[model samples]
Target: MREEFGSGAAGGAAAGAGERGPVVVALSGGADSLALAAAAAYVGERDGFAAAAVVVDHGLQAGSDRVAERAASQARGLGLEPVLVRRVAVRESSEAGGPEAAARDARYAALARAAREIGAAVILTAHTRDDQAEQVLLGIARGSGARSLSGVPPRRELGDGLVVLRPFVRADPSITRAVTEAACREAGLDAWRDPQNADPAFARARVRASVLPLLERELGPGVAAALARTADLAREDAEAFDAMVAEQIEEIVEHAEAGIAVSVAALAANPAALRHRIIRRVAEAEFGRELSREHTLAIAALVTHWRGQGPVEVPGITVSRAGGRIEFARRTGSPRRRRGCADGDRAEGGGARGVAGTPEAMEE
Candidate 1:
C-alpha cells in the first residue's frame, strides 16, 4: 500500500512539478480516518511530498474537542506535519434531511478552509465500501435517480481549486478498521469511538447496526460488495448520459422572455427518456431548479399528449405550449398567456405534436 501511494503521489507530482502541495487527510478520531492519516503520512514521506491532517470537531456531542485533540496528537506522532484541529458549528435544520447532512456539509466546508490555509490541493476522506453500500441503500429507499444511486463520488471539486478524494471507497470498512487499530496499537495510540454510532435513532446508525447485518446473514456475505459495484456501474452510466445531454441540449433550447424555451417537435422526435432528461436539464440550466420526477413528466405531457391542458405549475416556474414550442417562464402575479390545443387539432410536421389555439393563463 505504501509503495502504491508513493507511485501515485510521484506520478501526480511529475505531472506538475511546482504545483505539488501538502496532502491533507480528514482525521475523525475513528479507525478509518486514523488509518488514512497514517497511510498518507507514510506515502508523503516516501514520495517527497508534504503531509498534513485536519481534525474537524463538529461539536455535536460532548467532549468533541477532546477527541479532536487526541486525533491530532496521533496524526503528529505518525509524522504528519502541521496537524490541525478545526472547530465547526453545526446548525440544526428542521428540513427534510436530518442534522447529519447539515453536519457533513459543515465539516467539508471546514476541511476546505483548512486546506486553503495550509496550501493543500487535495483532501482525502476515509469513506469505505461499507459507506458506499449504505449510501446506495439510502438512495434506493428514497427512489432517487441513477445519479443518486451512484453513491459517494470517488473524486469531486471542492471549489477554490481543491479536490476531495475518497481513496478508501473500494476498501471494506472492517479491513480498514482492523488495519487502523493495529497501526494505532503498534504506535501506542488509542482511537476514540463515537457513541452515536450505536444509537438507533439515527437512520444511518440503524442501517449500520441492523439492516446491513441482516442482509449479510440472509443473503450471504457479498451483498455489500455487490451494492458497491452497482454504484460504480451507475456512475459510469450517469456520466455517459451527462455527456450525451451536453452535446445535444443547445440545439433544441433557446433563451425566452423570462425563462427558456424548447422546441416541442424536436423534443418529441427524441426517445421519451432523452426528452424527459432534456426537460429537466432546461429547468436546471434556466431557473437553477431541479424538477421532481412528477413535474418533469407533467411538462413532458405537454409535448406528447397536448390535450389543450393548461400550464403545468412547478416550483418557481410554469410550463406551457404555444407557437410550436414549449416555454418555461417565471411565475408572476400578473396574468400570463397560454395556448392550448382544440379538439382534433393535429400536430405540425411530426405525428401528433401541435396545439392550434392560444389559451392565456397566469399563475399568481
Candidate 2:
C-alpha cells in the first residue's frame, strides 16, 4: 500500500510539497476514500509533507451532516490536520446532465473551494479501478467515442496551480473497491456506505449492480480489469489526438465577423477522424457546446461532400460553407452568408439542408 501511495502523480506531488501547499484528501467516509485517507496520512508523515482531508456533505440524504462529522472525526483520528467539512446544496434542475452529474458538479465545486481556502495544491480522490470500469461501461452503453471511453483521468487541473488526483484508479495494480474495504477493516475503521450506490434510479448504480456483474459472470472474470485497461489505452489515444488538434487548430481557424471560420480545404485535407475532432473542438472551445457524433459528421459533410450545402444548425451554432471556408456562428447571431458571393447563397440546387437535433452528442 505504501509503495502504491508513494508512486505516480500523488507521489511526485508529495516529493515536491516542500515548496507548495499541503496535499488534501477528499474524504466521504466511504471505504475507498477512507483507505485513501489512511494511505495519504501515513505517506505524508514519512515524506515530511502536510496532509489534510475535506469531507463534502451533499445533504441529499437524512443525517448527512452526521455522516460528514463522522468522516471528519475519522480524518482527525488518522493524524491529518485541519479537517474540513462542507455542506453543499445540489441544484438538479438548473444543472445539465441528470441528477448524479449535477450532484457531482456541486461536489467538485465544493472541493475546489475547500482547496482554495486551505492553499492546497493537490486534491486526492479515491476512485478505484471499479469506478473506472463502471465509467467505461457506461461510456460504451452511450455509444460514446474515445474521450468518454477514456473515463476519469488520473489527474486534471481543478484551478490555477491546483489539481485533482485519483491515485487508486491509475495505480499499476489497480486498487479495487474490495481492497479498499479490506484496508479500512484492517485499520479498524467503519466505512459508511452510501445507499445511492445501489439505487436503481441512477444509471451508474444499475451498471454496478447488474451490468458489470453479468459481464463478469458470463465472461469468466477479469472483465472489470479489462474495461479499466481499455480506459487507459483510450485516454492515451485521446490525449495524442487532442495535442494534434491543438497544434493545428490555430493555423486552420480564424475569427470571422461575429463568428468563427475554418478553411474548408484544410478540413478536407485531414482524415475523417481528425476532421470530425476539429469540428467538435471548434464548437466546444468557442461556443461552450459539445457536438454529437451525428452533428460532427453532418458538419464534416459540408467540407467532404460539398455540393453547396446550406447552413447546418446545431445547438447554439450554425455551420455553413461559404466559398473555401466553413463558417460557424451563434445560432442567434446574424444569418450566415457565402463570402465573395451574393447574399443568402443557399445550397446549390438546394442540396440537403442539414439540421441536427438537440440531443447531447457523444464525445470524441
Candidate 3:
C-alpha cells in the first residue's frame, strides 16, 4: 500500500482540466473513497477541477443516512461545498442474487444522475489493485473466461458523457486506508464497516476474509502483489485480444434477423483460444453479458452438433445456429419481436443487474 495523506497527500487522478469545472467524487465512506474524495478536493481546487462529492445512501441499515451526512461533512471539511447526498432503494431479488448487487446498481445509477446534474466530467471510484485481483479470482470461479479475469479498466466511459476513473486500481487497498486514517485523525473522525465484508456466504467475502490470508501464509508474503501483477498481465492480454478481435470482427460476424451472427466455420478455423474469444465477444455484442468458458464450449456444440437445431441458454442470453452462422440473441423475445441487445457490462450483464466485481476461477 503506497499512500500519502491530508495536506501532504500526493494527489487524485486528473479529472480533465478547466479554470472552473467540477469532478464528482462518488464517496462511499469507505477508506478508498474517503481518500479519493479528500485527494480530489485538494487537487481539484488547485488543478481546475472543482471537487464536488455525492454520497449515496442505500438505506440498508439504521445509520445509513447518518453515514451519508458525515460523508458530506467530511467533503465540506476538505474545502468542498456541501455534498449532495441521496437516498436510493435496493430491492432484493432471489436469495442467491440478493440486495447487495441491486444496492450497487441503484447507487451508481444515482451517482450517474448526480454527475450529470452537476455537469461533472469525471466520476472517480476507489477500486484498488487488490479489488482487481479479487475480481480476477471471482471471474475464474465463474469460469468467465479471459476477459473477466482481466479486471476493471483504469478509465472507462460512464453513461451521459461521464467518465469513471479509478486511480488506485494500480495501488493497494492498505495505502488508501492509511491515508484515510491519517485524514480522519486530523479531523477527529471514525468510520463504519459493511457487514457484507465478513459474510462467508458471498464468494468475495470468503476470498478476502479467508483465501487471501491463506495465500499470504502458504505463499509467504507478496501474495497480494502477485495477484495484482497477474491482473495486470491478464488485462494486457485481454486488451490485445479485443483489438485483434475488433479488426477481424467484420470477417467473422454479421447482422442478421437473429441479431449478430458469426460464421461457425470461420470460428472453427481459428485456434481453440481464439475461437473461444470470438464466441465470448459475439455473445456480448449480440446478447449482452459474456458466455462462460463452459458456455463457450456449449456454444461450440452448435458447430459440432449442427444439423437442424442446436440451441441453449447461456444464463441471460440464448445461442443458436442457422445454416453456417452461429447466432446469439437476447432470450427476452423471438427474432420476430426483437430489436437489439442493450450495451452490457464487459464482464457480466443481466437485464436487472450490472456486471460488478464477482472474485475466483471457473472451469467446465
Top TM-score model: 2
Tens digit per residue, CA lDDT, model 3, 33-65: 777777676676666557788899999888889
By lDDT rank, best first, the candidates go 2, 1, 3
Local error of candidate 3 at 311, Å?
Answer: 4.5
What's model 2's lDDT at 322?
86
lDDT of all predictions: 0.73, 0.80, 0.67
Clashing pairs in 1: 338-359, 338-360, 339-359, 347-354
Candidate 3's displacement at residue 34, Å, is 1.4
Off by over 4 Å in 3: 1-12, 15-20, 94-96, 171-183, 186-189, 304-323, 327-364
Write out the backbone clash pairs for model 2.
Answer: 292-361
Residue-by-residue lDDT tens digits, candidate 2, 253-307? 9999869999988998898888999999999999998776767888999988888
Model 1's number of clashes is 4
